[model samples]
Target: MGTTGGLADDRALLGRTSTAERVADILRTRIAEGYFPPGTRLSEENIGGALGVSRNTLREAFRLLTHERLLVHELNRGVFVRVLTVDDVVDLYRTRRLVECAVVHGLGGPPFALDGLAGAVAEGERHARDGDWKGVSTANIHFHSELVALAGSERTDELMRGVLAELRLAFHVVDDPRALHEPYLARNREILDALRAGERTKSEQLLADYLDDSRTQLVEAYARRVADDGETPH
Candidate 1:
C-alpha cells in the first residue's frame, strides 16, 4: 500500500481520545487540504497505524466518508478517494446556489458580522501574493464555508461541509489552480464589501453570479480535462 503523505503527522491530532466520527473529520479535512487527492488508494494499515486507531475504527471512518461520496470502496481492491465527474460538478453548484444564496438572502439588517468573510478574503489574497494558488483555493472554500455560517444553523454548516468537501474532489482535477481560483479572489472581496455596506440584496446577487460563473468555469474545464484524458464522465 502506498503511503498517504502527511497523515502520519496528523496522528497527534486525535491524541488519546479517538472515535470514528473524529477520525472521519480528520480524514475529511485532509482530503479538502489536498493531502489525499482524488482516486488515491487509501491504505488501511498505514492510515490506521498513523492515527493509532484500531482497524475497525478506521474502517468505520472510511464507511462514513464513503457515504458522503468522498471515498469509494472496491471489492477486493480496497478504498480510494472519489474522482468527481462533470455531472457531479454541476449538481454541486446547483446545491450551492440554493443554499448559499438563501443564506445571504435570509440575513438580518446591516452591521452584520463580516469578520469571518473579511478574514477569508484576506487569507486568499495572501495566498495569491505568495503564489500559492492551492492555498488560495483552500481559502476560497473557507470563504464559502463562512458564507454558509452566516445562516447560524449548525445543520446547514454540517451540510455545506460535506458538500464543499465533495466539491473539492472536483477542484482537484483542475490543471491550473490560478486560473480556477484567482479570478474569484477579487469577486469574493466584492461580495464582502457589499455585505459590509449593508447591501444584502446586492451581496446575494453577487453571490448568485459568483456561483454561476464558477460552475461554468469548472464544468467546462473539467469536461475538457476528462476529454483530453480519454475518459467519459460517469
Candidate 2:
C-alpha cells in the first residue's frame, strides 16, 4: 500500500510539473500570437478552469511569465498581458543598441557558435515567406539574442532576453510585420558578413543603425495603433 501511494504521489508531482509548463507555454503563445492582446486581463480561476489545471499551478506559471515581462501583475486587478508604449520601445532599443553594439565590437574573433544565429535568420525568412508574422518576429529576436551572446556575457544575454520579450509584446500591437521586419533582413545579413570578415567596427555601426530604425518603426506603429483604438498604451 505504501509503495503504491508513493508511486501515485510521484506521478501527481510529475503531472503538476507538466501542467505548469503547459500553462506557461499556452500563455506565452497567446501573448506572442496576440490572441490575448496587450492589456487584456487573465483571470486565474477562468484560465485554470478552462485549461483544467488548479489555480495554484496557474499562479506559478503566471509568476514565471511575469518575471519574463510577458505578463504584468496588478495589485487588485490581476494579471494582464503587457502593453508597450512608444517610450518603452525607445527605452528598450536604447539599451539594446548600447549593449549589442558593444558586444559586437568587443568580440575578439568569431564566437563559439554562429550556427544558431544563422539558423534564426533563416527561420525568420522562412516564416516571413509563410506569412507567419509572429514566428518571424520570434526568430528575429533570437537572431539578435544569439548575436549578443557572442560577447560571452551571461548577464547581458539575460537582460537582452527581458528586453526582447517586451519588444515582442510591442510587435503584437503592430499589424504589418513585413513593413517592420523585412527591411532588416539585409541589415542583419550585412552585420553577419562584417562579423565574418572580422570588421567589428563596421558590424557594430550597422547594428546600431538597425536598432535605431527598428525603434523608429515600432514607435510609429504604436502611435498608429493607439490612434486607431483611441486608448493610450503604456
Model 1, residue 87: what's the lDDT? 83
The prediction achieving the highest lDDT against the true structure is 1
Model 1: per-residue Cα lDDT over 119-178, one tens digit each: 999999999999999999989999999999988999999999889989999888778889
| Model 1 regions lying over 4 Å from their true place | 1-18, 231-234
Stretches of candidate 2 above 4 Å error?
1-22, 110-112
**Structure candidate 2, residue pairs in collision:** none
Give the worst 10-residue stretch by lDDT in candidate 1.
9-18
Clashes of each: 0, 0
